[model samples]
Target: MPRRPFSPARNVKTREASQALPPLPLQDASAAIAQSKYFLPGEDLDGLRRRLARTLAAVEAQPQRWEEAFYHALHYAFPGGRIMANAGAESFKANVSTINCTVSRTLDDSMAGIMEAAREAALTLKAGCGIGYDFTTLRPQGAHVAGAGATTSGPLPFMDVFDAICRTVSSAGGRRGAQMGCLEISHPDIESFVTAKREAGRLRAFNLSVLVTDAFVQAVLDDTDWPLVFPAFRHEIGAVPTIWRRWPARDALHTVNERGETCCRVYRTLRARALWDLIMRSTYAYSDPGFILIDACNRMNPLWFSEDIRATNPCGEQPLPPHGACLLGSVNLAAFVRKPFTAQAHFDFEHYAKVVRVFARLLDNVCEISGLPLPEQRAEIARKRRHGMGYFGLGSSLTMLGHVYGDTPSLAFTTAVTQTLALENWRAALAIAREKGPAPALREDIELTPRHLAQNPALARDGHKAGERLPARLLHARYAPHLQAIATLDAALIDDLAQVGARYTHATSIAPTGTMAASVGNNASNGIEPSFAHSYVRNMIVPGEKAKRAVRMESYELLAYRALVDANVDAERLPRAFAAAGEIAPQAHIAVQAAAQAWIDSSISKTINVPSDIGFDAFKDLYLHAVAQGLKGCTTFRFNPEVHQGVLVREADLAATTYEFQLADGSRVQLPGDALVEYEGGRYSAANLYDALKEGFYGKL
Candidate 1:
């Protein structure tokens, strides 16, 4: 029999479903408030929501109207972490950017240029924004350095400076600065960069990724020799730090000289498959240096002509250009699912679409109101107006709807949801443009847009590029009827958009959410990710225990326990539909993320969890499969003895061993891990949020 397609009501008559979902218990609610710190015990949540709305809406011409709209949308509640933490809070509020991250262009290859870039990065980091940089601009090893009168040390050493700066400044400004570093696959020093994180405590503040190319993937598949090339002609015997090495890599027909150097200046060569294997092995074992499809990012970017997206913000979402900051928000999908787990289960479409459109306006207001750190970033904001509005609690939402995450029905449902939103997101941008004017960069000129450039292949190659006709993430999305009410308007707006453009450059993305939702928004699932476990231990740092004991944490799903009990369901049990991260297949995981990615204009931060016991060959196939699946980037995690921490822990694994630790009062207690460590009153990470929850020292339920 054919399964029923999801049909959300066009107009949600009541929030009876949301009211039915269990309210956060007192202890959990206390912990969540303690984590968010936006409201005090006696204060109503609406008070904080009102303050946030007033502050953000103040940017609009008519603040009061938008303020009410903002508060209404606040019911959906998935604003970015920075906004929740700082918005309208007198204690930490400022002209500071509420955006969580930015990627800075290291201006030049010289020491002065790098230092200048570092200074810029420091300023951005100090403003509570994480940063990213592509180290590809640095000269390869053995390059002459006239200033130092020595061969260049390569990009890795320079990255150490950024790393040190990050560590020093991470917690300096009441926020931890997250950093992401990227190097290209064809770079000569790529080997060193790949193995960088193998050392314990090395580059502790930075996440690394290799900017992979289509050529490299094809080369690996064909088992061809891939030459690592740099600008050989641009270098002199002792000249140091030259920005442009006026040399090009050899074409296929180019021949090698007698000395074995290609005329186009190949630095070194290796079998593509060998390099591919190393990356896979490192990812499988050490869990650093993920892959980013550089071409794919630029190819689909809304402002491709204006910038190059070489790196992403720390979380691998928001693939951005230099001087770009991440202004993000998410809609809580779990909140929208009605009659959860029953045959009558469905999403509240009217509410969802209304929330998306209203949130879109809210992000546009953020672009105006927040004081971004850099002049370049400010200019980017004024001209492009990028915002990463996305969704969280996808896994929980699917489970609530009785669909297993990574299953076909769930895939279709999410596709429909995202598709509906993608159109609405653009429509929102267009609606804003109608009043505020399209971003300065957006133009009707065929010469500038990717759509037009595609018509002329040669000019399209370098001059100007077009944005996606159909974003990769939504290539398969289909919306419900309420969205259809806007679909015609959406279509009209898009048709006008090709000529008039949008207020924002890029609109939709899937963020990591990073406990913003977990603690702040009633413990919603992480953005577009599944639950880590049915129940697991989370390390909660208590007072005066910066180095001692931990309070345990529990899953939000447990909130439904009381309701489950009333429904004659097992409160302690997880259903078959509750597909935790580690148990799901990697392919299934990627498939789910890819389905969401199709509609997203920016990127999605989702970790595909691979079982530690999986063989190397199967593990390696994961990355290849990600590429085939058309993912913008691929990040995978497996629990190895080397990196013992993980995001989700199986309940059985918690019972694997008894770990003993000293309490603050000098008393000792035995817990669930192989070893015990002091719990500081801050964020915990074995390396990832998923890992943190899965394998942290203690968990309270």
Candidate 2:
């Protein structure tokens, strides 16, 4: 009888049977990303999901409200990269932050002040947060520093110090740190700042931007002389010729007016068009130093009564004041499509709203656990309770619904989805405030000023006088331009909000979402961008490693179409509805962004892709058009292979380009960028390997 086969008791809870089996192997690309980027020791894919959902929900003021069903929503609503990676893992570590974006306290002009700012930035970066700084406050080169009795080296050299600091922190922390360096358009060092990235290996850790003012735009359009100015030095204040201009910093050397302009001494003057051309040419070639409409940002700011925004986060999505902080999350729009690629296809907005509402609460909870490094940073969050709840996968979702990106139908669809998301976010904010007291800033009494009246003329039309005192809730809901637009959709909701303030100062900002979209979103198109290509190679930086590895990637739309419609799909030959970033017209991209911007309070991070062959006239015209279209800011990308390796590379571009590699033995080898080479048991694309070595990050990894 073969020893009776050692049969176990029937229905018995045996240890082997009772114990949970290891989670099923990762189901798809998204799982693979989660395992590598997010998972901790002894954690599998499901373990990560459970851990994230459990940990985040436990911090909620009303945990029981979302403890059960919130887990399901996590599948569709993705927290930002920092939030997902750090929210639940605090138990295993110290000095980590859940917030994704922060801005340093206004940098002082003294050397001690500069070093203090750098120290705060280091602590912030070490905690896995991206920070921004306004450098225009510093005196320009050749300016007298009374304390040191020497001419300053100017803001550009200080920026280099910050860049190096970012690099060092990124290397030691095992998480790449990001920084944004902003200089006002009127700064004497603007020219140098505009072309800073042209030099290889300079400012490697920063995303540079010029804070373009409305006055500067007017001067450029008029082709008139533009003054380069800085705050008058204390000793020479009366001797210097001064002009009144809007400035971010204030001190005894400067005096503010009812209109918010400060007195500054002119250092130099140049033809505005010449400066504009320089900006356009440098950006066209280097793909950076994006321009932020500083005037527009301040005018549209919800906290205009209290804050003056001079800089934005690395990607230019969140324009922030000194010491400001914000957490970020996104709802996966592609996950809401029903009956994709069919005549009856439609977005399941009902379910989408549910996820957005839950996500808003989860983000609100993050404020409680925000482990910001500095006391001011933490205080900023506690006061304003600002968070950016955005969405990703607009491009992939549009394709899935049979709409072409940047087309008429696509613009309409984008508008509808964004409007719905914005409204729901506000509603969630209001509901949360009703449960939990409103943000501290909202409860305070704020004074109305001439700037407020100028920003919102409707207030004067309504007989509201400047210098009047009003509750911040009323100022935000009834006076803020963004909320006034929200009132058009739901007057009662806005009224309720006025009676009881919202949970956060800002509700929506679309980030680039590069890594988040690629990994957790299963290669979804980035925020507000069409697919780079149906199939491409992405050079991704590995945390804790020096080198970047090129990974082959496919668009989410292509994967869905292949799985749902055609099993044998050729990526190169797709339907008319399929369009990549390179194929779309510049106007179309701006139109799509404008449609979304109408509802978004915070800025949108979008790059209007232009062909390298596009003429300078056409390239320059895009910025003017963006300004005319009422966009808060605009950024464009044109490939320049000589400048730097792109984050995303199309196979066709790679195959067409050639790379020459110089070995340590003084021998050289030439290969197409797409060619693969195996070395030390590891494989890498020729272009990526060359770039890694040239950039001095290859040998270690």
Best by lDDT: 2
Minimal lDDT window, size 10, model 2: 1-10
lDDT tens digits by residue: candidate 2, 1-701: 01111112321222222121121223255565666667787786456567767877797666766766667888787888887788789677678998889998898988999999999998999999999999989989998877677899999999989988888888777677899999989999999999988887788789989999999999989999999999875666678888988777787766666676887899999999999999999999998788999989988888877788989988889999999999888888888887666655688888898888888888888898898989999999999999887888999888777777888999999999999888999999999999988889999998777877877788889888877988999989987788889999999999999999988989999999987888777888888889888888888765544456777788887887666556576887676667788888999999999999999998999999898799999999999999998899999988777777888887787888889977779999899988988765668888887777666666543
Each model's lDDT: 0.69, 0.83
User: Looking at candidate 1, what is the lDDT of residue 592?
Assistant: 92
lDDT for 247 in candidate 2 is: 71
Off by over 4 Å in 2: 1-32, 255-260, 543-546, 664-667, 678-682
Top candidate (TM-score): 2
Residue 141, candidate 2: how far off, in angstroms? 0.8
**Candidate 1 runs further than 4 Å off:** 1-44, 90-95, 235-264, 443-490, 540-551, 564-572, 647-651, 654-701
TM-score of 1: 0.83
- For residue 637, what is the lDDT in candidate 1? 84
